[model samples]
Target: MLDFRHISAARRLVPVLLIALALAGTTAHAASGPGASSKGLRLAAMLGSQDAAKRAKGLSALRAWGQESLPGLLAAMEAPSAEVRRGAVMGAALQPAPALAMESLLNALGDPDATVRSLAAHTLARLGPLAATDVARLLASPTHDIRVAAALCLSRMGPDAVPALAAMMRRDDPPVQANAAWLLGGMGSDALPAAPALIHALDTDDTRLIHVIAEALDLIGPDAATVLREMTLISARGNRPFSRMGAAAAPTLVKLLSRPGTPMGQMALFTLARMGDQAKPALQDALATGTEGQRAAAALLLTGIDPNMAHTLPEDLRRTLGGAIHLN
Candidate 1:
């Protein structure tokens, strides 16, 4: 939430903090590491500025100190003034390795101010894997926004985040489950271990949850293919609607082309077309069968796969496939 005015104020306080740190026996040449620098002390002072504008100036100054301002910023986090503590947390997050701010950020997670907590979550999550531990801690936080921040961070972290994400899947809330499933899908093969659970999630009575699980299956890829195939078989054999399963299994539908006798092969081709060209070979195979439904679905998929492929179909086939091609 730091804005233009805040940035200007931070710039103004840099000089003051540097001078104070210089007088306080801290120095760039000292073994104690990055100290207050004139920038940090003045920035800390601004935290006590009675005027909102002056306070913004202080926060802005601290943020500007960046990594070199860490020692001072860390000290400021313990300030009795709420503004100073908030400013310190904000400044620390701006460090290149935000992991350095993990402790301070974690403490701020329980701040009485909702805004501070939310900002802390945003910074930690954006830091990616560096903030993984803190993000995991926040996953169980009572606040919804904190949980959301953790989920988003885990999603961005991809596969490395699956363990924590999977653990949270046991929650009763469908939205939480849905986000967890989506993140697992993004993990690609790393998420293979979670395939069975994800597949099971697709069967939830909630159609919305089914969509989320299906999307996860698509992301889990080759790892989930066998499970998808089995699901397809069970659905077809039982004469189930298979709508949600088919929709979710879009990516795996292509494999059906390799297993001809399974009713799923052609049936999957049509759905693959719905998913786009990854199903090209399967659709091509379907085209040859030329039964009205098979040819029609093939033509539709071909247009999506490649317009050139659609044009390549014989005049007779095109005429026979007219309605399916959707040339318009």
Candidate 2:
């Protein structure tokens, strides 16, 4: 009974109405949650987009989705492009609960690209103490770069890294020992517990290692005062094994005299000025009987701690220090 023209128009409009309804459904689904699998695929593709801006937007959206973004990011980690893999790692780090992506991040640590590996390590660090166990494993890797990256990540975890770093200090490998020392030093007073191990390592003949150990001791601040003073005295005596200890302690010693206007500062200055006298037996012995280099070293250190004593020095000792004593 309907007109042919009207029937033809209704048929033509049927497909257009169906398409609009489908788009509306999709829009509503996207608005509700990222639970739709298609939405996830689209986001993942966006993350791997060659355009940097699109990748950044995808990362932002994924972070907004929170835990919902984890699976897609995990999948993106295996993207053929190293760039996509790097982006995935970064996106994982930006999630509201980064620890949720820990497994994916741990796997990314062994990525072929160095930058990706480094980024993965840093991302784990951003997860804080929660990433400690996985990061600890990387420390044992035979690869130097991986070990170093792990050390850096542990350093960023603050006090939580103490146990792992303290253990590393005992390793026979010099680089391992050096990296551990550097991180411990970065911890400041928190690293006081590792002082004994660091002091023990100072027995090495490597000047580089010695320098790092001294720096670590210095960074431990007043907590290391007792050890510092002992090492300083030994170094002052011109002992070969502890030769570089004095130079290492110089900055910390000077800090003690920083508040020259305060009572504590006055005490520090007094103690430093008399350090030469306290070590007088060694100093005198060196000036009276040691070689030119030994006497020069002893006199120079003495003159540094106490300038007034310069007049009392023997002619030869004075000459060894290059004429009148001058403290830089």
Q: State every prediction's TM-score relative to the real structure.
A: 0.43, 0.53
- Best candidate, TM-score-wise? 2
Q: What is the Cα-based lDDT of residue 220 in candidate 2? A: 73
Candidate 2 backbone collisions, by pair: none
Give the Cα lDDT of each candidate: 0.57, 0.60
Compared with the true structure, what per-residue lDDT tens digits does model 2 show for residues 1-328?
0012332343344334323322321111221334544444556565546665665556556645667767766777887778667656665666678788888788777778765666676678777767776687676677766665576568667788777677777777666687778878889999877776776566555556666766776777534355654555435544455453443433333333324344323433444445545555555565675456545555665677677667767876766665558534
Write candidate 1's Cα lDDT for 21-61 as tens digits: 22332122211324564455456556444555655555455
Clashes of each: 10, 0
- Model 2 segments beyond 4 Å from truth? 1-45, 48-53, 56-68, 136-140, 187-190, 224-328
Stretches > 4 Å off in candidate 1: 1-86, 94-103, 107-119, 126-140, 170-173, 184-196, 219-226, 229-328
Candidate 1 structure lDDT: 0.57
RMSD of each: 12.7, 17.2
